[model samples]
Target: MSTVAVIGASGLLGRALVRELGTCAGWRIVPTAYRRVQGDTVALDIRDAAAVAAFVERVRPDAIVLAAAERRPDVCQHDPAAARALNVDAVRTVASAARQCGAWVLSISTDYVFDGSAPPYRIDDPPAPLNAYGLSKLDGERALLQSNPFGCVLRLPLLYGPVLDWSESAVTSLVPAVVASQAAGARPAPMDAWATRYPTYTPDVAYVIRAMLEQHAKGQAVCGIAQWSGDEPMTKFDIAVRIARALSIDARLEAQTASADATPRPRDCHLDSSQLDALGIGRRTPFDVAIGEVLSAWPAPTPSS
Candidate 1:
């Protein structure tokens, strides 16, 4: 049976990857977590290059998925050192370790690498990151490829799915604001209506990764750059509206026509998922249906004392 080592198994997409690959026949999963290591999840700090190397030698899986990163845009802008530590340095560490152990690596990346001036970004499009987070991810992508010939980069757009809390994802985080706005005499909640986002489902991404792994097992490892994303585009206001609808609550949500985020964001960096589409490696759950599934598990807030 072939084995795959998944780093950052405690995070949103990482959990989904583990859950998806766990069901596949003839596969063994070695999941690692840094902050919340528990159960079968191994404790690993990717930033510690020596420890990472040691871990790789011990596990020696056939493939590795590097999913750990400091993804917050504002945080990245404020603390670039930390972002680089995880997104870039840690990526290099993982790729190097994987290469030495004869394992291929798949590193996660973001569409923010582009300036969002263009629509339907292809794999070949020149990246022009506007913020620290995007820049770090772009650098990390380069680091992975540079460190390992067998490494691949999968760039994704904004994501949402099974979340620990509404704050865990941008799409789900609007729930609190939506609920608060519905209260009598409450002020309208302002939401960004400028930047468009594609809230791809994490489980669907896990499914695609499993397909790539299946291909790798067949001696057809996917290398270099590839991308996958949800087809639907919606702004924060749009998503909030849907959340309100799902809850059957009429909420006051104001559309912010102009950009308000302190950190610079691209207007529409909609990644053209043609590469994965060509390989028939993709899954898309409609926003309405998928959002409902996410919200169902979330218990309503307790009333104020």
Candidate 2:
């Protein structure tokens, strides 16, 4: 039985990976958390190099799936040091430790690495991140590849599914706000129409990782960068309208042009998953079907009397 350590195991993506990977046979799953500790998940800060080294020495996992990072652009813009620490420095730490222990690494990255200037970016596209968050993640990717050439980098887009809080994911966060506006009689809440995004499902990402792991076990080369994004490219407003229609909510969503946010964001950093497709690694779930599934699992909004 091989052991797999999932850093940031309590996060939205981490939780989905844990749930999905747990079902696979012949693999022992070890979940590690930082702030929130839950069932059998060990607490360890990836930013601390010494601690990470020690943890890796102790567990000696066959693979380390790094799902932890400072994901929010606004937060990264406000505090770049923290972002660099978690996104870049921590990644280096994990990769270094994994390399020493002869463990393969699958680091989770984002589509933000590409400037929105180029739509439908390929795996080999030169990264020109538009924000601190993207830059940090790009740096992390470099660090991982530098430290462990045998490792894999999985670049993902906006993900949503099984979040502890609405704010945890970009897609799911819209639900509470839309519900609130509807309750307050605030019809047509402003939503961004300028920038386009692919709202990929978290479970789909987990499936991709599972496939990669299986390939690695079979001694298949799964190194370098691979992307998996949602098939449909829609703006936030488009997503809001779909959500409203799905739940039969009477909330009107006004389409507003994407403004100059504190952190400059790409207008359409859509990713091309041709590499993953070639490898037969993952499947794309339609956005409407995925959204309905997510909403069904989420807590229903309280009806206004």
Q: Estimate each model's TM-score.
A: 0.98, 0.96
- Please give the lDDT score for candidate 2: 0.88
Question: Residue 180 CA error for candidate 2 (Å)?
Answer: 2.9
Candidate 1 CA-lDDT value: 0.92
Point out where model 1 deviates above 4 Å: 302-305
Q: Clashing residue pairs in candidate 1, if any?
A: none
Model 2: lDDT of residue 66: 97
Q: Pick the candidate with the highest TM-score.
A: 1
lDDT of 2 by residue, 1-305 (tens): 98999999999999989999989899999999999997799999998999999999999999999999999999999999999999999999999999999999999999999998978899888999999999999999999999999898999989988777777888877876576667665565688888899999999999989898888888885899988888898988889888887888887677888564667999888899888888988778888888898888766565341
Quick one: best lDDT, which candidate?
1
Q: Indicate the TM-score of model 2.
A: 0.96
After superposing candidate 2 on the true structure, give the runs of residues whose Cα lies further than 4 Å from its correct spot: 184-187, 303-305
